[model samples]
Target: MDLSRRTLLTGTAVAAAGPALARDDAPPAVLVSTWDFGAPANAAGHAVRLAGGSALDMVEAGARVAEADETNASVGLGGFPDREGHVTLDAVIMNGRGDMGAVCALEDIVHAVSVARRVMEATPHVILVGEGARAFALEQGFDTTPLLTPESEAAWRRWLETSNYAPRANSENTDWPGGASDHDTIGILGIDAQGRMAGACTTSGMAFKMRGRVGDSPIPGAGLSVDDEVGAATGTGVGEDILRVSGAHAVVEAMRAGLDPGAACRRVIERLARLRGDKIADHQVALLALDRQGRAGGFALRPGFTYAVTDAAGQTRLVRAESLFS
Candidate 1:
């Protein structure tokens, strides 16, 4: 791999022989997810794969781990609420066949990804929002529960003191002064042994954001895109900019145009850099991709971005993504 186009963390390799390894040597099944928390998520997803689950099952199983984690303030039940203390969630699920479903600005739903799947499987609509989404979830047998925990409520109260709503670059990956890290979304992609691809993305949106704010996570092609013949991609970070460029779809298209997964992700980040220029320094964005051959790569606008990968053999590793401004 060219150093200019792809950079790997010191002492970390995307695969034992790196991403450029021959296709025949690629793992029979592969799972990749955004952020350090994704390591365990991948493990959870891998268990599904080991049980003969499809790519769709792997992605969904993986996402549920983070969504149920109360310590993870960026996703699911314990996520930080909006300015009004409303904990709205967003999620999307996409299959390689181009079918997708999403939910945005949903309240009191812990597993928004499952609701997204229900939307895809049960409804003619591609999306459901707010009250409609909650109703649909209830009709689908999903229970409504209070998502706000004491820890998150305390964090929201602390933010109420200053009421400063400035977006911080990599805030999801770092510790705040008086509170736990206000994390971001979890995006998981998988290619099963049969080579089918699928992806899922779920988030609580930006911490202390305006009520009803929806980010890229719930939008297909922005947060996630999967093409069985081409590849799959998903993103995290400042979703506004990611959505503006259809970040995940762009990476998959680049892979179709012949770029490796890493280079494809880098291409999109470079475009974001040019579009935002110096302003890009104020926020963070990152993308992770998996080709049909089970190869994977990731890139970010700033450092400290990490992703987790698990192969067919059940080996898992956390990789610090290469960044443009590192």
Candidate 2:
């Protein structure tokens, strides 16, 4: 389970799966995102790319799919609420040109990613928070509606009995409709035919968390980072840990230092493990990266992390990412 052994195992798995795409033959357009739910999101984003949309357009379009999925309890509409029974969303969007925007602890706005985009385009500020974010969204024509559904409220009530607040690894992949999800964040990264890059991250944050709790989903360097000259990276899982190391930005810097997308992601996971030691086993921090050449890869602190990839051919598939622990 050490880093070197894990690297060897991951390398063997990669070899068995297939060789990495050659840079010269890399797809002109590619989309990659976190989790199984990301499959449909990738398809949506890919459609934007096929329709001649910019990377910015592709990422925003993709993130909206998950934000509107009623069955997903870790995102928009039915997301699990905080201990106070309020569902506050966090989201961020960034483009290769360094333009970025974010909203944290935002309430009543389902398309938080789009609001983040508006923050980037309409205001000189890069972030908006709480009531201010909601006000901005409303002024921009976004409708205000309750995001917590009956199922989520029931689950929150059940959670009050034990009041256990331990963060769970990969809980978002569980039976979400039954309100069994926690701490799931959807992060999407894309490259257009023009080779432009963009990334987005959104989530309702950890289930039954403190009322004002905001995770890495809305933090630029922690949840998402994009660079036209290098690549883009995004993370999902326990946000606090990711924030400590600026995980997403670290992955992009590693890629800029000449590592492949997978290697870059793995290197960041290794750093996170070293930083947290044995405690890392109790939480998951998965990272997905896409290089400027359209190559994509993902890595995680533990098993059970999967990402969706959509290539130029319009084929979308889920990839189970390699992990530091067996």
Candidate 3:
């Protein structure tokens, strides 16, 4: 009955327990997310976890903060519209128990993450898309809201004049007040008071993208994946590059194979470069991972990707992502 010495295992994740359990849990739980804007969600999730909430609930609540922010152009209510002027959202939520749900290319629903959770808990299906997703959200009692605000509309109009689809180098994540956009998603991973892990991925997809285009955000393994015993992982930036490798799942698999969080994130980015060097040379992709023990690591294709972390003491701050090019 030596639980401390024996290895703890998650569905496909395994970890040495003794040393990890001995590490500081001062702020006993940990929350990590993809970008600076995630600071708010990290704080919100931290509060819930500190109060003995489930990590799954914290992750969902945290993600909802961004989903409701009209100023954040990459996710939720006021996100930049697609090329055709429609603001479609995609989101996914997964818990330590392996239960998961997602919504893709869903229009008019601001709380897309909540809708995704309903998909995971209320229905037998794992995914719902387009009108089906909208219909389901409505059925779930979520009211319709305008996703594309006047500010976003004007930006789409301005973009239409030149009609350029190529994303600029190092696009702005909060350029809404400023048309110009990774700059991509708010992917979060965390461990709760009871040592359970959960993760969530939410985004409005690429700015001014093709109307029906969907990215890694709504795809479980690509955008987010969690194994309560081992850890959880999430990805941001260019969803296309992230999708090609199922980025988040790759990180969790690496952890299962004995790589620490930092090493796992590095290996994934290196593999991505090896597989799509030419296509990803100019694009950005970033990953953030947390082992069940509360250790975390973040890696990216470029230097601008920053992530936020909060410990059990209610303290939170952003960590700059390590880049392969650097």
Candidate 4:
């Protein structure tokens, strides 16, 4: 046979190549999302990615970022004020290892959720709130910024210029205008490949809300849930009803009872709906869940609810909830 350059090249390539090079290794992946307001909702996913941190670290860091961002308008300093025009903050954290922490109705602390994490780790109690929460934050050396941002101050100025009421508007429909502020919440659920989990939630009360009004953020099982054996869940929506429903815990339990992540979320939603007689179409909640296998799913009433999630394949994407039940 006559030797040719092409034949020589083919033989050399086969000889140099190894049999083990069949598949490329997967990069990291995360699924991120949020409600109408953005920013903080997806920030947790970002923190987790940067640190390769567990769910607990991610949730705390994400919440602190939102709490510190003046423009977010939902969780921290720049959030709309209560009826008297004062800002307040709330936060909570939980680990699947049976540790929990929270701070509610806090004021002036730039990173309320971080303070709450310290309480969970350092104190004997699982929750703390109000003046005591602030005192602890100060004692811990957490920095304090002006309670109101320029955006928030301008919002307040407009409120003063426009009307006597607390600048309340209908978040869902301005025409039907009900509450004064969004009182929206931010939560996270972190899961490791070993099946460990952590969760956190943060928010300011509804703007121009009744003085001393406390929501579900400080309540366990309402804001978030982490169960090393079953799965983890984080809740969003009306706080009181969520607490009553034990929303996140219920979602986790549903998974324990053989429900898939989607079905588990729907089951909890159905429970909430049923509690309200299933009559009010406006009732809403959102959730994300991950099993030991890293299989994940999400559910919500409307089209826009979203969660940030990371998978073993190293693919990260934003997951907008759909009516998996319907």
Candidate 5:
């Protein structure tokens, strides 16, 4: 559906440095995510928020929804395997107070977002990677298991038919080519009972990626970022393009500088196009943002980019994001 700015921003959120549209004492609230496929995650996160959980709690819980999904080759266990047939994961979490944690090049663990939270609440470090991330997951009580699923295996074999290591922008992992970006991440932002914000970003990196390749999913300020005083942002599409300018952080900074949620997102998209020059034509990069006051906006490099929103009234919808190329 075409969501007007009013419809996109419809919801009550926590008290933030910016003026909120709703009352300060608003009880429960809405959540926003990077992809149209994020409704399930938004539902899960909203359920947790309804039960009085922290926004951080809901954000992690919500991301777990995507982690467990096998049909979506872009994320979690069912994701497309690396060129070596390994399914490595990357994830990050940013809490209300600006504390952050991440896991990169993680293997076998289905719930990478939870492991990221452990790094935030359990360790003094900001990131854990490779075998170290697996160790942290093991110590945190996650059982080791093979992440490669039957569906992922079948897809990998299909890719091997060509045996072409040369990658296309959106040709890998998905059923067909030319829709979404290759490096898509499930990114979510939520505000709970308390007037605070938190967010999560998780992915299986790029499909058929090189062994040990880690995308922006586990990188703060690239895949996701939250500032209670200003707002929050998440990204999908080309991780490399997102990382160059720390896309999410840039959006938050724009919001802080007086751009509303939508305007900030559009400005970031413009910047991405300018910085990347002609490279972005073959790929896509999207940014989604929500201000402390509950205003939201999204923009993308290509024609097809959509974000999900679940409002206080429990209505969830997929809205086509504004796109420069469209």
Candidate 6:
């Protein structure tokens, strides 16, 4: 049944009148989203769904899966490092309850952001950074690894051999009128059986980032934003502009304004395009939204992005531009 934005937004009884109510093996109705498919983020989502976990649990579990995979350059484990060769990680988690937790400029500990959640639940702070974040991870019994791996070392070594030291436009060095450029990061959002919303974002930060640069991944309303009463948004590309645009929050609010997920994502991208006219090449992003009713949609500046949803019949599939745009 194709439901209009008006019906989806205003009708409080959609579950009783939609396909979601008829499926016997609904599989918790989880949807996983990321900028790139065949990446760690996708794998993480698959793992969580198979484990019968909540969307927030899936996001954290999936992020950890990404952090452990060495092949993904944008996320943890073997991801890019600073000029100093430290592979610091940044992560954040937000629950439907509006309580949020994050770790920024973290090092040595994989899944550092998950540790931040432990802190969020055990302590009173909403954010943690640097040495403090690392110490907390250690206390939580997270095994310490030399944040840098041989593969990342080799990649950096090869990079140094080239003259690409000039930072990209989206690097934190940019001096824009409103906000600095943001960096690439892995972001995830999921909706579970209980209609609860949760989101998490993780990244090794920008390549050649400053020794301690931290971007929007761990900042609420920037890298990731979730409102159970509305929808959830996760941002990719320049976190700085994402922060100024409040890209994720913008999409969620747009949804509230009656825009479908695709329109909401398009609106956010259009604004960013105007902000970084000439430097638009590197100022890219992907945004995904899922309303409380289990309808899913997303938009991205670049082609080939991925987002997933479990439809009314309970079949879950990894969605990409090839299947969506074409």
Q: lDDT: which candidate is best?
A: 1
Best by TM-score: 1
Residue range 1-326, candidate 6, lDDT tens digits: 32223223322321121332222233334555554332345455556656677777867876777677676665787778887778988888988788888889888887766886786687799888899988888777889887688878987888777737644433432333112122256677777656788888888887767788887788888888898988787877656667778888898899899876656777887787777766656445667777776666666565434544454334544443211121
- Candidate 6 ranges with C-alpha deviation above 4 Å: 1-29, 38-52, 166-184, 310-314, 321-326
Weakest ten-residue segment in model 4 by summed lDDT:
14-23
Model 6 TM: 0.79
RMSD each, Å = 3.3, 4.1, 7.3, 12.2, 5.7, 8.1
Question: What TM value does model 5 have?
Answer: 0.88
Model 5 spans > 4 angstroms off:
1-29, 165-183
lDDT score at residue 252, model 1, on the 0-100 scale? 95
Candidate 3 lDDT by residue in tens digits, 91-187: 9999978899999999999989999999999999999999999999999999999898999898889999999898543676444211223356889
Residue-pair clashes, model 5: 0
Per-residue lDDT tens digits for candidate 5, residues 1-326, read 22225324442222122322332333223698876567779999989988899989989999999989877787887888899999999999997577999999899899999999999999999999999999889988998778899988998999889977653444443542222432368999998767689999999987788898877778999999899998899998878888997999999999899887777877888998888897767877888887777666777776556677677766666655656775
lDDT of 2 by residue, 268-324 (tens): 989989888977678888898888877777888887776777788887655567788
lDDT (C-alpha, whole model) for all candidates: 0.85, 0.83, 0.80, 0.62, 0.79, 0.67
Clashing pairs in 3: 27-312, 27-313, 28-312, 172-181
| Residue 163 CA displacement from its true place in model 6, Å | 5.0
* Clashing pairs for predicted structure model 2, backbone only: none
Q: How well does candidate 1 score on lDDT at residue 204?
A: 89
State, as a TM-score between 0 and 1, how close model 3 is to the true structure. Answer: 0.88
In model 5, the Cα lDDT at residue 134 comes to: 97
Candidate 4 regions with alpha-carbon error over 4 angstroms: 1-33, 36-52, 156-183, 312-314, 324-326
- When 4 and 6 are scored with lDDT, the better candidate is 6
Better of 3 and 5 by lDDT: 3
Evaluated at residue 314, the lDDT of candidate 1 is: 84
Candidate 1 or 3, higher TM-score?
1
User: Tens digit of lDDT per residue, candidate 1, span 227-263?
Assistant: 9999899999988989988999999999999998888
**Quick one: ranking by lDDT, best first?**
1, 2, 3, 5, 6, 4
